[model samples]
Target: MDEFTSEELLEQLQQLDEQPRIEAKRASEIGKSVMQTICAFANEPGLGGGYLLLGIDEPSSVHESFTVCGVTDADTLLNTLQGNCREQFESPICVKGQVELLDGKKVIRLFVPELAPSAKPCTFKGKFDSKNKRKTGIWRRGLNGDYECSQQELEPLLLAKSGTSYEQIQLADAHWDDLDLSVIALYRTLRSKVRPYAEELQASDAEMLYALNLVRKQQDEWVPNVAGLLLMGKPLALRRLLPSVRVDYVRINGTKWVEDPEHRFATTLDLREPLLRLIPKLEATITDDLPRHFRLKEGDTQRSDEPLLPHKVIREAVVNAVMHRDYQVNQPILVVRYSNRIEIRNAGYSLKPEATLGDMGSKLRNPLIASVLYDLNFAETKGSGIRTMRRLLKQSGLAAPVFVSKVIENEFVATYLLHQLLGEEQLNWLTQFSHLHLTDDEAKALLLTREIGAIDNAGLRAITGLDTLSASQVLGRLHHQYHLIEQGGASSATYYQLAPQLQNDDQLPLFSGEAEASSEPNTSDLGTDTSDLGTDTSDLGTDTSDLNPATDTDLPEKLSQKIEQLTPKARRDKLWPVIVWLCALRPYKAEELATQLSRKETHLKHSHLNVLREQEKLIDYLYPEVINHPSQAYKTTDKGTNWLKHQGIEIE
Candidate 1:
């Protein structure tokens, strides 16, 4: 179940190529042909998937040539083959290797599956050469050795994925009127751009369509491949054949999954043009004006710029989602729009087996169809789609798109953020702090503090997936970095909070403790964490207790202005005492401070009485603790007396 054995591979190679199948080659050792055969099999859809055996040969009597001729220098051969495969293949492909016995002789089997449809005409050293004109060429698994597929054959190979066989299909019953003249004209125009000799093939729109096999004869009438209908057939013709293939756009007012949606739309049309048209519309709806600082002739100038989402990012993401999505999955491609993000989740995993978005090699499951889309400018340059999207997003002041090729679900989800990336200031801090002496888990645990506001040791363990000891080490590092302050004991009961100094500071912290950790975590993770948390509003500029408007609400209009002018207290007791005396018993929402203190919500949004209590600025700790647990209470801060004097009230 895990790998093909050499003996099994030999049995496979012995079978003739009747229909699409695979060949497994096993060897204690192998040669260059092994690599060539792998590339060849990957190029041919007709071959399905192929394999290479690593060990075992037949009995000497059964076939001397195929007998167990134990390979010399096996380890060296393995390394050489591995290097060749890595350097030569356009995208890295795997060949399963396993040690086994054939006829009591040791051997190794190497299994090579044919390239997925997403990868067409398997390439060698970055070039697609099916004809074998170049010594360095790719191939289709032939009955004997690999054979080079010619350009004429290659075109059909590409087209076959479009689910058509132009060479055998012919349009008979349909007349000239049945063909969409506008579509035919557009095809002609596009064809001329790539093929200079297109004009010489003189034929009416109907004839041309038939000649190209876009419209084939079916029961004495014209028919089309799923691709042909999608690309050129009239809208009415397409609706009849490919109804389920479509795009769904869902818009939400916030980032979470359950937020209210602004609108939704589903499109079933010529995927190419309709998608291209859809980008600008989505952009117009969600795009925002961003504030930017620039150097002008007069002085440094600050102005607002257009939305952050780039045109190229939108197009590339859309194209990738459409091209690679599993048409068979029966799920419509989703374009999820949120207030600050856009996620495109298609219905299929990566065409390249076990591949991720970071991988740049080409292995398409539907190569024939993908090739056509690229030629028509509706898709990306092969192997560069994800990379291009990353570059574009970064250049436009947004974080790079996150690509997920989930194998279990067979889906590809690309998340694009319509927000600014780490600025030069943040980048400088990150770079300066890269050499900090901290473990990965510890850094993550500390970062969680900044993100979720607070985290206990147990929370750290869950977030980092570390055992108690390991989690403790991580929390200890956070404490040493001064980015976090320990709240409880050292054991599992320990809790932590953001350090007051770094709580709202722009510069990220760097640890100067003993080095005992792995390399620094990647910036991508940092970007992800920052995007999740809206902003740094962790610190309030003032104390909490004097906020009760009723007790302090009607003292005097002029006195209120005078009290506001007084210096803020360093302790919450200054005001908490009076507010508690005024209101016998009642609870308040964190956001209720604005109404309670007779101030605007915007002004008191960041201020909290609990926070003042924690800082010990309160006059008396009525609760003896101010963690703001599920229960509610209040206290007075140190500035309460000065405030009473300003308000024309004497403090007892």
Candidate 2:
């Protein structure tokens, strides 16, 4: 069974979206109902295995969310499932179950292993023809629910049980002539580059092809096999033999595939070539379509324009798509290129479990094709593909590649986000906390929380490539020392979300009215709504509290020194409490803040003021619905005042 954190499990349930290897049950008791799902999971043909979670209630109302109600009697359910597995089938099913608390409620999750071929077609009462509303023993999991497998679906499993790999099957209709000689020559050239001393380079055509398992002597004639047809077969041969063998490269203009019927893709390049030839072409096509960035290298006066995405990474992805895609599937590999990311969807579920995706060990569906590509220097061996992508993207300051492998969909999609992860904008934002000297791990934790709303120690490990201990340590330091994020959950299920202060800042609008008046989005506007700044500060609610907090005598030593070091824009963070505290006393207009702070109305109103109100939820609007009201004024809430006092900011 694969390892997944409870946080991840909860997240999946909350979304109420079905996962190929995940199922949820909200029942208080375990019976044949739960057993049916287990049978389906174990006998799920090609899907590796699946998990069953009990105690999470599905959404009962449109407005309500999926909630973790937890099992009422966990011990009874666990014992029931264990006893049934022991007594029900011809061979005992191997299932592992445990009780874990979700949102503090005890829930039972079961991991059902895919039964071995010999033990499959897991039936009730040791037979398929059970009459207790269970018509057949052979069951399959589908989009709706588990159902009895029909003859068509059950037939494939019988064939797969014979221990024959798909790629090794001989295509009786295909002859040696179907193989492309040019591709064979290219393979030899690449092999020589990799292993110059190899004697195979000097071998005859038929001998080399035979050695590569491209053509084998079948009875009296040399015939091409599935491997041969895939690695270097002629275009027409593939078109006729494997009609869906092609790559669809689509260029979308926005972040997502356009759903609007009227919108068309920027460009679409469809290539149907032999695997060896298609890879390089596919790599180049995607790279050419990508936007480039300029970087200054050593001894360079001018910036160099290189593809934003690494070419090597692109090659690995395209190669894997062709090499691992299920040719049995009558679907083209769709490479959707949006402006910000590239998505490569192949019609195959990873043979290896999702937990071991990046492990060096591999489970190849087509070893012969893999070997041919290896000799041709097209793709990496084992599972180095994902590791290489991670290393390269990290070096370029981009996100780690994301893999979505679903056995139910029988497809795998790899997403490569083209933008730099923590580029100039994020870097500038982090500088406000430069005083902490945050490590990459800590910074990443904060960034992820900002992006995903929350992150767990397990997710931190996934992103940082760190062990459990290291990830936890980084999370701990951030939570305890810097107090940047707040810890939630307990023990191994622990996760973290951004502290309220940061959450508040994150909620602020990207632009104030005055800031948007400019052509470009400016980060410099660090304070108020400059467009609404009035004449002066005299109308500052007649509150002396603002002047009192601003006085040198009232300021604390540590904070005072930091304020002096920060620029006017940076100072807004520490001084926001003061601003909000003053606003709590009485309603004040934007111009009043400018006068009290002795700062530019444009800077104060455009940058800090709106962020303090919107994100922090500290201040309220005089005309909340009418944001641009002429007489709009601001006042702080009790939550804002309490937060200030909690942070040790005080009124003298």
Candidate 3:
């Protein structure tokens, strides 16, 4: 744990919100509860470490003020705390304690480092688990407070203790004959196609399995392993060893799960075949059921009917689910088909963070499985699968898939949107402003803003294949110049939402039909959201005619009364532009303009007839644009509609 400076420490003490990494206690003396915190800080995975403060009071609310209530006897407290850590805990925990003068009183600060993976689940001597429970000798820090680890939570730790990869672990007493020769032959055929010159294809079946580490010579016997079983085991063998291993293909009627009590799935299919055959079978079943769209490639002579999602994309998604999922969880891979979307949910979070999912190269959780798929040209171990999925979705005119990687639940979910990327309603709405000459990226950004409340750099990167720098430029251009999106946040935290006029949700079409429903929750913010691609730009249209409304204040007031007498409609005509220019320069009373033009009040109504004001535009009340105060005088709009033409700035 990094040591916190005095200022950093003081800021933490004053803050009202509780941080998972910070724990404050008024324990000036050693106590049992303090040890639990120490154990939790050390045992909890992933939050670098935690802090313990001896003399601080917890603030009740954000408005409530707090102060460091400093320890009275620092030496005695330190001695007792150190003794408790050494004697009461199952193991001697290492923590750095410092005595500081806070608010003119002594305060003890302890920084407990996260325990090494091997020595984790730090607990007190009494914290061991019962026989039926998995978590013994483990205390972990959660958001609310410290708690003991559950069985499921402790399994990952035990797997970590093996120091052997999951795929490499030998299946005890399983001999080579348990493997199917036909599966091995099929692998060789696939290897020949992808790696024509590879030497492994020529090796004997048993030798090939041994070379690939699928089968090992244990105690002079060639025994198979978990990877061997998954890739090539017969049906009966797999069922007896790993009954939970299979792909569950569930079809739902609408775009989401069948969450209602009475609602049932459209169809369900459980495939118990070996992964070698299950991969293609699952793809075929889904492709046959998905709606097809006719598309043409660039410079192509003919159009072909393609599924809303590409064939390769579905293959990659399923392959990844099988290749990267945590097989230890004893859960089947769930391939859910909704009316308009398909969701692939499997046990285990992604091998890498959500931010890096699109980047090449990933840490493989099941390299043995990955290697087989990679060798067969069925999947990639280098992380190109996500990039392919994104590109294909965009090419198909479908919204990009959303990948929600939940580390706490150890789950990875891929939501493949089946509906059009830009709905016909949304496109029709944008087509109204062809004059805006918006680029594709800008249009997509607007479309996103129209659906979701806002968009950010991360969102832009997922939708478009833009790098961080490129994404920022697109957002900045639309915000600073085009006036399409309003900017929010500061620096890296900056986000872009549609301008107020563009946020017309009541008109956009709702995303409906067989689109895959997102199994993951929509709880991410701009700072943490990853590839949501779920915004339904249902009702979006901007009144282009009303954009850039202008009311020039300083029109030429010296024009003749006849010129002033021009009707508000006639004032916008080319001939009356001189008077329009004069009125734009300065506000003039209808009577004054009538007198100047040598015309009656009735004539003045025609020439200086407050046309914009009558339309509730150029106002008769306040001169500062109608939305603000408009004066009773016949002033033109300040929003700059025809001000440019009057100044000879506009050619037409």
lDDT of each: 0.48, 0.68, 0.64
Model 2 lDDT tens row, 371-428: 8787767778767988888899899878787665656556776767665547555676
Strongest candidate by lDDT: 2
Q: For residues 1-652, what per-residue lDDT tens digits would candidate 1 score against the true structure?
A: 2354565445533421111233334444456567767777667553345555544353346663334555555667767677777777777776655555677655555556656565665667755544554333556643234555445435545655555443233333323343466765666676667775764247766566566545555566556554455455454443344444555444443433331222211111112222223343333333322122221345636543333455566666666776676654444565655544566767666656332444576776555446556766766775787778777766656655545454323456666645432444334544535767545565555554543345554455443445444555566566765445555422112357667875666533222110211222112222222221122111111223343434456544544554455344423343443343232222244344445545554333224342333222332233221132222234333344444456555544
**Sort by lDDT, best first: what order?**
2, 3, 1
TM-score (all chains, Cα) for each model: 0.39, 0.58, 0.59
- Kindly report which residue stretches of model 3 are placed more than 4 angstroms away from their true locations once superposed: 1-30, 45-112, 121-135, 141-145, 150-155, 171-177, 218-221, 419-652
Q: Which scores higher on TM-score, 1 or 2? A: 2
Give per-residue CA lDDT, model 3, range 1-652, as digits (tens).
4578544665754431224667778786677678888988887655567788888775556535456778888988988888887887777887888888877888888888887778765667876657757356677764336656666666566666655676777766577777788888888888888888888877888788888878888778788898999999887788777767877666665543423325444555667777899899778777777766555789999977666678988898888888888887655787777655677878787657576888988788888888888888888657788888888878766788866555434567676766665788779878866888988988887776565445666556666766555666777778877788786543223456677777543545545433332222111221222121122100111112212223322223333343546554553443345444434544455555556445576555543353333322332322211111112244444433355455554312
Summed backbone clashes in each candidate are 69, 13, 60
